[model samples]
Structures are given as structure tokens and as C-alpha cells.
Target chain A: MSASPNQATDSDRSEVTAGIAAVLHPAARGAAREVPDAPPRGRTAWSLLGLSGIGFGLLAVSIVVSVRIGTSGVSYGDLGRSLGSRLGVAEPLPRLLDSLIWDLRVPRVLMAAVVGALLAVCGAVLQAVTRNALADPYLLGVSHGASTGAVLVVVLAIGAGSLGVTGGAFVGALVSFGLLMLLLRRSGLDSVRVVLTGVVVGQLFAAVTSLVLMASGDADATRAITYWLLGSMASARWGVVIVCAIVAALGLAVVWWYSAALDAFSFGADTAASLGINVRRTRIMLLVVTALLTSVAVASVGAIGFVGLIVPHGVRFLVGPLHRALLPFAALAGAVFLVWTDALARVSFAPQEVPVGVFTALIGVPLFLFVLRRRGEL
Target chain B: MRITVEDLSWAVSGTGILCDIDANVTSGETVGLIGPNGSGKSSLLRCIAGLRAPTSGAIRYETSDIHGWSARQIAQYVAFVEQALDSDSDLRVADVVALGRTPFRDRWRGLSHTDRAIIDAALAQVGLADLRSRGWKTLSGGERQRAHIARALAQQPWGIVLDEPTNHLDVRHQLELMRLLTDTDQTVLIALHDLSLAARFCDRLLLLHRGTLVATGPPEDVLTPDRLRDVFEVDAEIGQDSLGHLTVAYRGTA
Candidate 1:
């Protein structure tokens, strides 16, 4: 297999057209910071981040060590020395292992982790912002919004050089966010109203996405659409890694800025307003940030769902709602989750790929529900 | 620190709620607002806190019209602890109290040392220091009410508007909370359903009936048998308690 992580192999890279310029993001806005007095809420946030980072670090090292062991039998002595040769470290061996790690798998898995982090962090924010446990990229219509934009690009046959599917998706998600905010703001910043409105918008866009997919030409188009919905990191490259990183960092920064407001929001709007938050502005900015985060993740992997919704809730169980703690922990949990999940995807059935989205939803949903059940809810 | 309300009126939609009501609170005094349901106790508090926009009236805080101040600006001067809704589950005890610093904390930075100390003090004041790490939703009804008060205390305001702060508090916690307000230098306007607590704690009482100011004076003068019968639809005997404090006993019929 010619699949690589740093940049897509020629066959995989063929899926995405080139020359899309990356977007520059604004400095941090609307982060949920720890209250001046809130002792950092959770040991879990720190433990989650620490444990997951270690897990990924160990796994990455293992993958590198495994490459040197060989396909035949795991050679104990040659493992370190053989790996050293492949990485061009220690001494050059007969074959290169560094190439296998850096180019073939490392970047791809890392991107998967980052993408997962973005989705999960956004999910946490979206759930809090909307005050809906069920809220996520999938439920909020953000993914649908992005997919709508990407599908429009596809139907128009506009390739990467022209605004690109990513750009389209970002705009679509943002537009949906604006619409939801307007609707919810007018209806009284009630939590149930926001969730219900998101549902309506999600349904509307899903209908549009289906119509577009149904009308598209050939089995190839349908297959592409299905794969996109299921999500994958087949198109990871140095350029994508850079762009997505910048965007995700920007979104997280914005979320950090709004941490105080989010703290207020966890109580109802009246309580938040009494806390001296500029509720309208805070709400608008948070919606915008979560939407952008969701869009960027959607653009890269194509509509992965439960990671965003489930990851944050999981983090909250360990940490708490102080978004300052929640957002960062959620981001880390998400990153670690996707990395391992993608690894499972790679190993579960070799050669023919299963979309990472399927596994995430499958794993995240039951797990999140279990957490909720423990907390005494649906 | 002094608050003056003159000719205040408010209406929701086309229906009138509070009509031409006037009240006042001097600095360092606790003013109890007593009224039956639909008598505009909450509406009046909302107007005082600038949560509601009153028509054709002036609420002045130290000679500046409070009506012109934004909610955030008002929050700097006044902390309003409304009745606790179902306790906010996502917040821990300390976090709930620290939110009072929402007016003071920088948007993105961690809380200042002073902010942390004050939050600690507020939690301790409410006897909830031990519950600091406990979730807000798990607290008992009385505890949640106290937590909300602690949140208001975090604001460090000059005036506090409390809408039935004793609503969910048990009799003991209610007395404790009410007594907690006695030492405050800030002017406090509290809405109370229990006239006994009001008579015990308040220096002055503002009685409203159907959005009209029925009486504004000390509890001794305001809690008259006639006023109780007319305003609350109950017959009551009003006299001095064993401690020589004015008290009231409700009878069977209006």
C-alpha cells in the first residue's frame, strides 16, 4: 500500500485537487476561562490530557519500533538497530523506517487526532452554548451546513483552486450558525429553543444534502458522498496539517476568550446576564467559533459526528463545566480518541478502509449514553 | 448607595403590571418588600436591578438615573440574586460563587488572587466552604439558595436586590441568610413572602398591593391588621414579641 501520512500518496492524493489557499484566523475570542476564583475544576482534565498524550506517544514509538521488526518475525535485537537504519538515525540500515513513520503513518494519524480534537472541542462548546447534551456538529446542522457548501462545489465541478470545498463548508457552517443565533436570540435565549432550532436547521440541510447526492451522476459520485459522510483522513498532507492546525488553534483560542461567558451560560441566560456578561455578543461569538471549528473539521474529514458531541461530555464528567478546563481537556481527549480510533480503523480490516466516522459514532454514542445514565439522565 | 424610585410604572405587552409605584432605600439599610402574589414585588425588584425597563419613572442610584445604566453597569453597583431555578448542575460550589466576579474578571485570563480570595470568603460566609468542590445541582434546596447568595456576594456590590432569597431555604437557613444581611453596609431591597421574617429582620418595609404602594414605613407601622387583611386576605393580630420586636399572628378568617 502506498498510503502515507505527511502527504497523501499519489493514488490517494488524486481524490483532492490542489492549490487551495489556507485561511488566516483572528486572535482568540470567547474562550471559557477559569473564573478568578474557580480552582481548576478537574484532575481528570489534566489526567486525561496527560494519559492520552502518553498513550499516543507510546503507541507512536511502538509503531516506529514495529517497522524495524519486519513482516516475517519480530526480531528483538534488530528492532532498535533496524529501526535506527530506517529513520537514518544511529546507523543506516538496509531499509528506511523513519520514512514509514513520518511519511507513511505519523502525519495521517496525527491529523486524525487533531481533527478529532477539533470536533470534540467544538462539540463541548456547542453543547454548552446551546445547553443541549445532544448538541454536536451532526445535531447542530453545522456538518450539514459544511457538507452543503462542499456538495455545491462538487456539483458545480469547482476544484480546489477555486475557493475549494473547505472554504465552501466553512461559509456554510457559519451561515447556519448565524441563522440559529438569530432564531434563538429572538425566541428568548432558552436552551430547549436553541436545541430545537438546531434540529430544525439540521433536518432542513440534511434534506438538501440528500437531494444533491440523489441527483448526482454515477456510482462513483454516490460512493464519494458516502465516504465523505463517513469521514476519513485519506487526504492528509503537510499543507492540510498546517491549515487545519491554524484554524483549530484559532477556534480554541476564541473559545478560551469566551470561557467566562460560558460559565455564566451554564446557568440560564438571566443568571448569565446578571453575572455582567454581554450575553448577546458572547452568544454570537461562541456560536461563530464553534461553527468554524465544526466546519474546518468537516472540511478535512467530511462530517464525522459523535466525536464532537461525546468527547466534551466525557471531559465534563471528569473535569466540570468551567469551559476553561473543559475546552482544553475536551480538545486533548478528542485528539487522543481519534488517534486510537483511526489506528483501530487501520488494523481492524487491512487493505480495504472503513471510514473513521463510523467507528467514532459507534464508540462514542454508547459510551456517552452510559455516562449520562450514570448522571441520571437519557 | 441610596436608591430612589419615583412614579415607576411597567407593563408587559398591553397588560399593566406595576403602576405608579414609589419606594426608596437609604444606604446601609435593609428594606423589605411585602406583597401577595401578583402584587408586583418581583417586577419592582427587576426594575430596580435594571432587568426590566419601567415606563415613565425614575430609579436613581446616588442621583444618577439607573434606567440609563446597562445591565453590566448596574451589575457593578448591584447584585441581584433571583430565586434559584433548578440548581445549575454544571457548576461546582466554588465556581458558582466565583461567578460573582464575572463583572470584575478579565475575559480570558485566570481569576486574580483577590478574586479567588473573595470567592473563598463568600463560600465560607455561606457556610459552604466544605462543599466547595461539590456540584451545584447536588446541593439541597436551602444550600442552593445560599449558594446563589454567595454568587451575589462575589459581585462586591453597593446594593443587593434579592427576590425571595428565602424561597427555598429552610427556616434555619432562612434566618441565617436574613441575619447575614444585617451587617451589610450596602442597601438591600428584599422581597419577602413571610412577614414574620420581614418583621424580624427589616429596618423598613415597603408594602405593595396591586402595584400600588399601600404603605412605606417600619414593620411596626406597615404590618397593621387592616393592611394584612386587605393586602394578603388574612386576618392577623399584630403586637410586640417577647423580645419587644413587632410580630404578627394570623387568625382563621379574613
Candidate 2:
């Protein structure tokens, strides 16, 4: 079989050589000189800026529309008045409507956007670092680790009185990420090994979470654990929203700063290193940032799936794969996507809210399939 | 810049890939590295490019030891082109070539006008100026090879190290690429399998066998029939063509 292929290539080589020789001949020079004109310079930059502007515009619209959606019959006018009153620019809204928007709806919508942006950026960075399109925060099992900690607090009441489920989840995420780093260090930080180790470690943490929940005899605690696992923004508070938003912003900044290096990585680690990038240091740093962002997000709102897996892929189709353009657009599109998903979670069934994670998967699975089909990968 | 490899050796796992390899590449010289497959040509190039650290000995660029220099610092003076160029991105040809400026530009800054000019000149040199906007995935195999050469040219380095750069090119492109390298004043160390092309274009040839330097000299001295049989396992007749270019005709495996 190898000999036949070699014979075929030998024949092909002669034909190709003849063709190339013809191209190099003086008679063909004029024709070759008449080649296609260069594409207009700065076109990519203009398109990226234009697309980013559209993304931000869509995000603004999504926020406004999502905030107006709920069980209450509060009008946009009332929500505006409430926001204006808080900013000291208008008359105070009716006490009921003001507290409803100020204390509950606004923070929930903001947290949803922040978490979405964080997950999407993490997904982009992880995909670049690992050179695997399937990579995401969940791929590393940080969410499962966070779930284990949350379950321990919610079901077993371990640390519930002090650190609480949120605090416990954060710690769990850090521990899992730390363990992953240690294992990867020993395994030479190959992407495949990192992914495989994550799967094993993630499964172990998830089993522990289930074991804790099963051991708890309290039916109420079991129900709470199940609800949290499916994920929701219903428990979002101002403090959680503020902390998550800050962390997400910082993560975005760090990822954006490394966008060029990320573009080099799309070729592969060796190629990136050949381009003078410090591949080992850059990969480790990106892993740390993505893990941190994922931990903070999962801690705030249970393990929300799909946003991290699908958002970067979706954004890449629209703006191509350069990270400088992909990162910002992914963040904006992700923010808008989750805000609407959270809105659907609130109103899809009316009164009895479904977990926002369910809605994201409902939307994400079809979108992912569509993208794969379009790319001809499926 | 002159690159001096003094008693250099590299090992992978427990086995040596390169052993006590000594060679000197003076500025403005084109040196051909010729050997059978697995003779450590690529490994030697990687070490010189600072993509790999030698297990022992030293590589010096002019007066400075390259091992102590950062990858970025080394890249500013030396550009490397590996045999394989695989990119999963949809970046355009110009964008790929502009990546050569990575060592010079700030991480956050866009390419300046001078960078753009250098990229255009490099593209023109490789006759790919027309394809600057073409997607990298859309290029033919020969065109892709030229684009990579263009990228190395855009680096504007004092020295270049290429591993099997002509592997996929047609005969015309292979000759043209060698001519381009010979025309330049920069120091070059190119790994090649085509002995005739090496003999024609290189100022010096370094032959390796089993991780050791077997010969290093002008083509006439390095391409002797005895050495070819012993190192490459090929029985061949060597002579000069009408244009005074050295030619090799192989009869059979040794």
C-alpha cells in the first residue's frame, strides 16, 4: 500500500513540476502579473469594530427588554422611574415597584449577563489554549467541583452556618483547579492529558456531591440540592452581582490583553512558540484566569451549562477566528444571550420558573448542531 | 550574524538525537544541511532557533550565548520555518505573514505602517502579493509553502533556519526558493533532501549521519561518491552540468 502511494506521488510530482515550470516561463509572467487586486486594507478592523458596536447595541436592548419581563405588571416607564430615582435624576417610583426593580429584577438581570460574559470569555481562552474547539470551563470540571462544595453546604449542612454554599462552592472550585494544575504539571501540560485528567477528576467530585446528597436524610435539603444543580439566577443578590461583575470585567481585560498571543495559539503551541510567544507561561496563566472566572460564575449561579460551550463558537462564525475580534463579540453576544435565556426561564412557564440552565441547553443544543452542520463538521 | 555551534548535543527521553555536532555559519553565507531522514537536521535547527535547549555544550550568536537569551530576543535576530505549517484559523495570507512581526510589535498594538510595508514587500518577493487576502486554508500546497517563506522574509531577521522548506514545492518553486535564499545577504541554514539543489546553491554543506557530523565543506568535497554511499546509502555519479552547477545521478541503493 505504501509503495503504491509512493509511486502515485512520484507521478504527481513530475506533472506538478511541469506545471510549475510553465508558470515560471517568461511567456507566463505577464499573465501571472495580472493577478487579483489586493483586498482593501483596514477592512477587517472596520468590520470588527462595526460588529462589536452591533453586539453592544444588542446587549443594551436585551437588558432593557429582559428587565421589563416578570410576574409583576410593572411597565417600562415604572422601571425607568425606579432606575432614575436611584440615580437621583427623577421622582421616586411607587415604593412597591421601586423595590421590585431595584432589589430584585435589576440585580438578577445584571448577574445573568455578567456570568454569561465570564463563561463565554473563558470558553474562548480555553479553546485557544488547548487548541480544542470543545474546550470550556465545564470541560475542566470546575463546575462539578463547585457543585460538590455547594451540595456539601446545602444538603449535608457542612459549613452551611458559616461559609455557606456560595463560599463553599468557590473553595471547591479553587481546590479542583489546583489539583488539575498539579496533575497537568506532571503530565507535561499536553492538552489531551489535561482534558482527560479533568474528566476523571470531575467525575470523582461529582460522585462525591451525589454521595453527600444521597446520605442526607432530609427531603427538603435534597430538593434544594436538585434545584441548585440545574442552575438558576433566582437567588441572585446585589452583593453576588457586584462581586461577579467585577471579576468578569477583570477576566475580560486579561483575556483581551493576550488576544494576539491567543491568535498565534490557534495555529498550535509549537507554532506559537516559534512566533516568540512564551507558550508554557501563557497557557498556565490563561488556565488560571479561566478557572478563576468559572469558579466565581458557578459559585454565584449554580452550574449553568451550554453558554461556555456554544457562545464562542457562535461568535466565531460571525466574525471569523481572530481572538481580538472574537473575544469582545463573544462577551457581548453571551451577555445578551443569557439575559434573554434568564427572561425565558422566568416567563416560559409563568409562576413556576424552570432553571435557566434548562433554557440555555434548550437553545444551545440546537444552535451547536446548526453551527456544526454549517461548518460541515457533523 | 555568525552562529557557532560548539560540541552541541541534544537528547530526547534517554536517547541522543544529536551528538557533539560542531558547525560555524558566518554572516551572509548559505549553508545546506543534508542527511538521511532521522539524522537530527530538524532538531539541530530547533536548537539554533532557541525552540529547544541543547542537552550539552553551547550555541553562540555573534558574541552572545543563545541559551541565555529569551525566545523573543532570539527571534528578533533569527527566524525559523518548520517543515509543517498547520493552522486551524481562517486568517488571511496577509494576516499570517504579519505574524512574523510578533517579536517587534507590542502585544496590544496594531501593525504600524512600516510593518505593513514589510509584509507587502515580503509577499511581493514570494510572488504572492495577489493572494494576500486569500484565506490560509484556501491556498494550494505550493502556495502555502510560498506564504510561509513570505512570513519568514517578513521577519526581517539577520539569520533564518528552515527545516525541509521545499518538501511540498514543485521543481520550479524549489529552484526559485533556493535562488532567493542565495540572492539574500542574510545567514541561512536550510535542511534539504535534494542533494543537487544543495550542491548548486549552498556556499557550504554540512552532512550528518546517525546524529553526528560526517563532513562539512564545499559541495565538491562533501558530495564525494564514497560519502554518499556510506551516509545516504545511495550509489551515485556526481559531476557538473553545462552551467557549472553540480549534478547527482543515482543508480541504486547502496
Candidate 3:
């Protein structure tokens, strides 16, 4: 490298000048016109759709198989007949068997799928929105907030049953989200602040939950709350399943619509804004949506763990990081994953019936490490 | 597009970064913004690019006030490249370039045929057509700068603003990037720390001292030795190189 411009000869400078001129000449300007019709990059739209079709097929199969795997000895034929009869296409089963399948098993399987999908998509969105790989629904404090609300309701004997707990959880989740926004009001919602503030709020709520539970002095209620905290699909009913399904679908749609904006955020907020994203508005909307979805899920299932955190990382590894493909694929992969995990929890210990959250971590940790290793980030 | 900055001023926390600045770059002209550190060069460029709102006055692109436009609408006409921008995500070069078309497409649509063609053209223009599939992490500093420039080209913007784009480049790459910018027909407003490069490559120079525009004219007039001492706090000689280009030779700090 030449440190002194004074050493340059006129010929050397002229050569550089001529080189630039040749590169910028009108004939060379056609360099762009001569672009060799290169093949498209990454997966084509049809291939992506085909892959999504496979994922959906796998989820459907998982749900049906999951509904059949229990101590009741329900056969595949019985499962089909039950579904067909509900759809009015086949003969109805006996009263007890129909109630068992329709009112319990089917809704429980569907609820697990819905909850899993919701958590996974929320995780992926939060990870991108916050630029933090470790972000998940639990990290947002919404789950702990819900637990605190449900704990308070239970200890006080509000007496509206599960509905009262659900209502309390939703309100608690909202309060935590409100606090997060208030704390971030002057901070511009940057990634570090968002993640640290979320952790702080979650810790606060967790402490409150523990304090209320210890102060109540009711062993039975504490045991019940403890089981709920570990999360289960045992209480899954058609009403809650339907409500969760609707919210998850709408929320996923909202997040997916901002897929391009998420891509822009890869270079940080200033670049994202320069690329035409309304940075503040987009971040707020995404945060609110993710928090709401997590609230609805936590209220019903009592904070199922690992699915949101691990599923998105796994999906990103599989399909790359473009959120349009990443979000849907994550939803499908998560739904299938949870349906099977819930089934394993139900039958693994048989009469003991271990919590699904326990199985998720047991399975999720190794899978996450595998993904990290494959991505060369381990 | 011609950019007009009329009585523009900006402040942060009640301290003004740019004060009562006024300048204009006619369509297809290359203007260099030269100033020492903290002299409001980047601030003025950001205001013209519509990234920051001015505390007073206005920036107009041709006939329209850009402050009244959406970010998308502003992006369609003027592309901005900051001094340092990088990403940690697993985005390919082509994926980053495709981001340039964001303002044209809506949420319901994917890249159109025309969008692909334009992306190809942009890559070719920046000599990165073959490196389109390369991961961002794999690129060297100069290649990354070219890729960023390619992204700006993909926007098909009529005017481009860059702030100290050659900061980390080697001498050869710095010269090449300057040549590339000068060759482009788009109106260019760039901030440069290298007085010699700015003098040779840019059509006109806008010189700043503190928050005010101290000089604006051809390089020979703006790079006078006395102004260099007063504004840059350096004793320097303005001379012509063997190639008959204006050259600023710094003697020492004042």
C-alpha cells in the first residue's frame, strides 16, 4: 500500500483512471443487462409449500396417534369412528366411550398441538424481535405472572373454578406486560433492555407466586398449584382448546405478516427503519402479540416449557432464518413435537402421569445442543 | 433528484448537533461532506436521508418535503448507507440485497419477477453477482461494503447518501470505492474523512466547522490552507498531484 500520494506517477494515475472509465463505460454499464439468468437462491416457493405440506401431514398423523395412546385401550378404528361420528359421517359409539373420546381425548390432543404451535411461533418472533437467541415465552414473565395470578385466586378460594383461575392468569399476564412496557417507555425497547427487563419482571412475579403459596398453608392447594406450575394437558376441554386455537391462529397471522420486517431487523433497528420499517411500532406490536399468545397459553396449560425455546431454534436450523418460512414450519414442527411428548408423558409412567413440561426439557435439551452443533455455533 | 436543505437544524437533549445549515445537491451531482469528527457532517446527511427529524427548517427532495412522507416513500427515492452497519444473523448476501425491495412489496406478496431482475442488476453493478449466495459472515470488509452499496443500488434510488463508507478499507479498496461512487450517475452526498479523496472524486465539497457550514464550493477553493488550519486544527498544504487532481497534504496538527 502506498502511504504517500506524491509517489504516484501520471501514467499510474491515468491507468487507474482508464480502468475506472472502462468499468463504467456505457457498454460495460450493460454488465447488469448481461446478468446470466442465475438460478433462484434457496428453496423455491413450490418446494417450500411441499415441505410445509409434509409437515402438516406429519402433525395430523401425530395428533391421531396421540389420541389413541392411553390406558383406555382405544383402537385406531374406534378413534376414526369417534371422529367420523362427530363429523356426522359414521355411527356414534356408546355414551361412555363417546364422552371419553370426544369430550376428553380429542380436545386434549388438539389443545396440546395448539399450545405447542403458539409457544413455538411466539418464541421465534421474540427471538428475532429482541435479537436474542435465548428468548422465549417464559422469559417474558407472562407465565410467571399468570402463575402468581392463579396462585392468588386459588389461595383466596375465589370459587369460580378453572374459569376463575384462567381469568386471574390473563389479568396477571396483562399486568406484567403493562409493567414491562412502562419500564421500557424511555428506553426505545432495544434488545438488551427488553431481555433484561423481562428477566427482572419474571423474577419478581416468581417470588410473589412462591410467597403467596407458602403463606396459604394449604397442602392440597399447594400440591395442585405445584402440578399446574409444572403444566399438563389433563384439564384440556373443548372450550379452552377452541379459544386457544383461534387466538393462536390470529396471532400467528399477525407475526407472519411482519416476516419481512423481522428480516430487516437482522442489521439492527436503524437499518430496519432505513428499510422502511416503523421500528418502534413494529417492536411494540410484536411484543404485545407474543405476550398475549403466551398469556392465553399459560392461562390454560400453566406454562408448558421448552417447546417455545427449543422448537424455534430447531426450525431455524432446518429452514434457515427467513421468518416467512421459519414461522409456519416452526408451528407445524412444534405441534407435532408436543402431541407426541404429551402422549409420552401420559403413558411413560402410566398411572403416575408425569407432567408434559418435564418430558419437554428431558427431550429438548439434547435436541437443542444438536442444532447448535450443526449450526457450528456450539 | 435534487435535494434542498433549507435552514436545517437538529438537536439532541437540547444541544444542537447541526445549526442553521443550508445546502443543495442538484440531480446527478456528487457532493462530498467534509468535516472533522463531531462537526455535524453525518448529522446533516442523516437529516437529508430522513432518518432524523430536524428541530427546525425543512429538507425537500425536488418539489416535495420528505418529512411529510412515510419512511417507505422516502426510501423509494433516496438510499442511505451508514458508516458502520453489520448483522449477526444467518443471512446470505442475496437475502440482504433483497431487503432493498422491501418498500415496494406488501406483506401479501413475495418477490416479483421485476424485483428479481432488479436485484440481479444491482448485484452485477456492484460486481457481486457471483457472491450472491455467500453468507454475510464470510465476506471481508471491502466485500461487505460493496454488498451494502449493492443493496442501495437495488433500491433503484435516484439519490444515495453514505457516511464515511471507506473507513476500514485498504488504500486500493478505498480508491476503488471512490471511483465507483464517482462513476455512478445518481446524486451522491457522502461524508469523507480523507480530504484528498473527497477533493478528487466529488464534484463539489461542503465544508463544516463545528455545527455550521464554513465553506461550499469546488475543491481548490474549499481546501485552502488557512481554512484547513482553522477548521481541521491542522497545518496543511493544498497542492495538485501528478494526475492534476487536487491533493491536501497535511503537515502537522495546529
User: i-RMS, every candidate?
Assistant: 19.7, 14.9, 13.2
Model 3 Cα lDDT, one tens digit per residue, A1-378 = 111122234355344334433333232357655864444644567788888889989998999889899868788888889889979999999989988888999999999999999999999999899888888987779998999999989999885988888888889898988898999999989999999999999999999999998898889879988898889999999999999999999999999999999998988887777777888999999999999999999999888999999999998877878888899999999899999999999999998899999999999999999998988888
Q: Model 2 over residues B1-254: C-alpha lDDT tens digits?
A: 68899999999988999999999898788999999999999899889988899999898877567676666666666788877677766778988888887876677877766566667767877788889889888898777887877778777666789998888788998888887777666689999999999999999999989999999999999999999999999999999899999999999999
DockQ preference between candidates 1 and 2, better one:
1
Give the deviation of candidate 3 from the true structure as CA RMSD.
Answer: 7.8
lDDT of 1 by residue, B99-197 (tens): 888876667787765566567666666678789888876788888888887788767666789999888677888888898777555578999999999
Interface DockQ per candidate: 0.21, 0.15, 0.23
Please provide, for model 2 over A1-378, each residue's C-alpha lDDT reduced to its tens digit, 9 standing for 90 to 100: 011112123235334323433332222234334543343567768877788788888888889889899987768888889988879999998787788898989999999999999889899888888888898878788999998888777765666442398998998888888888888886777788878998988998999888887787778878877788788999898988999988888889998988888987766766677777888888888889999999999988888989988999998889878787789888988899999999999998999999999999999999999997886667
Residue range B1-254, candidate 3, lDDT tens digits: 78899999999989999999899998889999999999998889878888899999998888667776677767766788887678877878888888987866678678766567667877887888889988888898988888888888777666889999999999998998888777778788999999999999999999998999999998888999999999999999888889999888888999
| Two-way lDDT contest, 1 vs 3, winner | 3
Tell me which of candidates 1 and 2 scores higher on lDDT: 2
- For residue A43, model 2's alpha carbon misses the true position, in angstroms, by 4.1
Chain B, candidate 1: TM? 0.96
- For every model in order, the fraction of real contacts preserved is 0.33, 0.27, 0.41
- Model 1 agreement with the true structure over A1-378: per-residue lDDT tens digits: 111112223333223211100100000001112123355545645676676677567546644443332223334445565546657786643455545444545557668767977888878777777777777766567877777777777776776632476677777777776777677766765667767888888778778877887887656656776787788876666577778889988888888888888878776776777777767677767776777777777877788767877788787777777888788778777887787677666656766778888898788879988988877766
Give the least accurate 10-residue stretch of model 2 chain B, judged by summed lDDT. Answer: B68-77
